[model samples]
Target chain A: MKPTRVTNTIRALRFAHDEMTQADLAERIGVTRQTVIAIEQGRYSPSLEMAFRIARVFGVRLDDVFQYPDSEEVAP
Target chain B: MSKILYLGEAVVTHEEKRAWIMLVVSVIAYAGYVAVVLGRQDGGSLTAVPYVGALLWTVGGAMVASIVAEIVMGMANPRASRVKDVRDREIGRLGDHVGQAFVIIGAVSAMLMAMAEWDWFWIANVIYLCFVLSAVIGSLAKVIVYRRGVPQW
Candidate 1:
């Protein structure tokens, strides 16, 4: 599968939060650890609701957790 | 030891393990059924070989095997979370969509065969084969998605 255009700073955020384990973040966000891993790795772009939930877990704005490349940068 | 555990952790998820178990059990059960039916074909027509009992037993056995395998997996990996999250649900839906194509093909084939007055043996076997194909392909799809990561459109 193509990698999701949406990239995230979740790993960095997790690190900032005392080197939080993926499992702990998952628990806080009500998702499985693997889902957290997928989001962190940019393998899966989450649903809007899930995106909000993740942002809530980190106590950050959604943009702080996820970003998409500028349209001009992605064009061929 | 840490490296090995990390490697194991990186490789598979609980859902992937279930898919692997389903794939293996389906293959084994289908192979066993074929072997028994073929062994009974002692110079008689393949269609004439009694197959109903074998089919029933194999189907039932596969169900039991899948249940037992899941139980054993849970026991072995008690630490692994059994809950399905959003990603798991999406993957399952996608895999089922892929597998359902075979099921529809099987159903249509059976209907046509019945209309043409084909032998019951051929019709039954075709349905059974499709069912096995559905299981094999579905679980295989799930495993691949788990490895490759779910496509986010």
Candidate 2:
């Protein structure tokens, strides 16, 4: 697996949101289930538009859905 | 939650399985073509041989086999899942770019051979070899990218 500085709370949010499935999130985001799986596994990072879309699907802000750990630790 | 099985092994995704099928089909078709062409040569130069028939058969067979394999794969996994996504598209483009390098290499080599007044047999075979290499290497790259994570850029 490739290392990524970016991380996300999608899996947790999905579980918290009425136990939403990956397929559910994917359908809502207009992407494939595999894409959702990839994102959850940190194998892929979505585009900015997709990141916003994902946040919107969960009724959350972009920062609540995704985080850049390296940048976060450095900024503050 | 159904999965497609090939030779008793589960295939993860439609695109991955398709890559495997294309690789296999290309190899088999190319091997058959080489065998037939070389078998007719009897240790003589193959320059006089007519290869259009073999070339057509190999290319056509690979295409047909790939289509059939995809159809069967779809039937086996009838969830109507999305066939592609952003990641898939990126990986595909990466593979195509890698494979295209071989096509350029082949073209340049063929041009050099033509300048050297090589036989048509050599030029044609070189071009065909390059195409086969492109397909095989490209599909292999896609399979690798599917298994490993695609590189971040």
Candidate 3:
């Protein structure tokens, strides 16, 4: 499958928060560690509610956690 | 030590194991049915072979086997998390959708065969084949998604 256009900073946020493990973040967000791994690797894009929940765990805004590539940014 | 083994082994989730179980059981059951029916052919008309009993036994056996396998797996891995997370649910839904297409095809084929005055053997076998294909393909899809990540959109 193609990588998701959405990118996230979950790994960075997890590192900032006492170097939290993926399992810890998954438990906090009610998802599997694999889901967290996928999201961090840009292999899967979380649902809107899930995205908010993830950001809430990191105490950040949705955009702070996730970013969509801009059309202009893609065109070199 | 367990840590060394863990580092060497690929991480697998409970749902992925269940998918593997389903895929394996379906293929085995279908193969068993085919074997029994073909073995009975005895150089005669294939339709005359008694397939209903074999079909029923294999299908029923598959269900029982799957449940038993799952129970055994759970018993063996007492510490494995049994929770079905959102990603698991989504993957299951996606797999079911992919599998359901084969079910529709099976149903349509059965209907057409019945209308065409085909023997019960052909109709029943067609439906059974499709059901097995559905289970196999669906489980495969789930395994692939688990390994490769769910497709976005």
Highest DockQ model number: 1
lDDT tens digits, residue span B1-153, model 1: 322112224435678788999999999999999999999999899999999999999999999999999999889878777778888898899989989999999999999999999999999999999999999999999988877778765
Candidate 2 TM-score, C-alpha based: 0.85
Task: Provide all candidates' interface root-mean-square deviations.
Answer: 4.0, 6.1, 4.5
Worst lDDT 10-window in candidate 1 chain A: A67-76
How far residue B48's Cα lies from its native spot in candidate 2, in Å, is 4.9
lDDT of each: 0.86, 0.83, 0.87
- List model 3 lDDT by residue over B15-43, tens digit each: 88999999999999999999999999999
Q: Candidates' DockQ values?
A: 0.38, 0.28, 0.34
Off by over 4 Å in 1: A1-3, A72-76, B1-11
Identify the leading candidate in terms of lDDT.
Answer: 3
Clashing pairs in 1: none
**Which residue pairs in candidate 2 have backbone atoms (N, alpha carbon, C) closer than 3 angstroms, thus clashing?**
none
Looking at candidate 3, what is the lDDT of residue A23? Answer: 78
Q: Native-contact recovery for every candidate? A: 0.34, 0.30, 0.27
Instruction: Give the root-mean-square deviation of each candidate in angstroms.
Output: 3.0, 4.8, 3.2
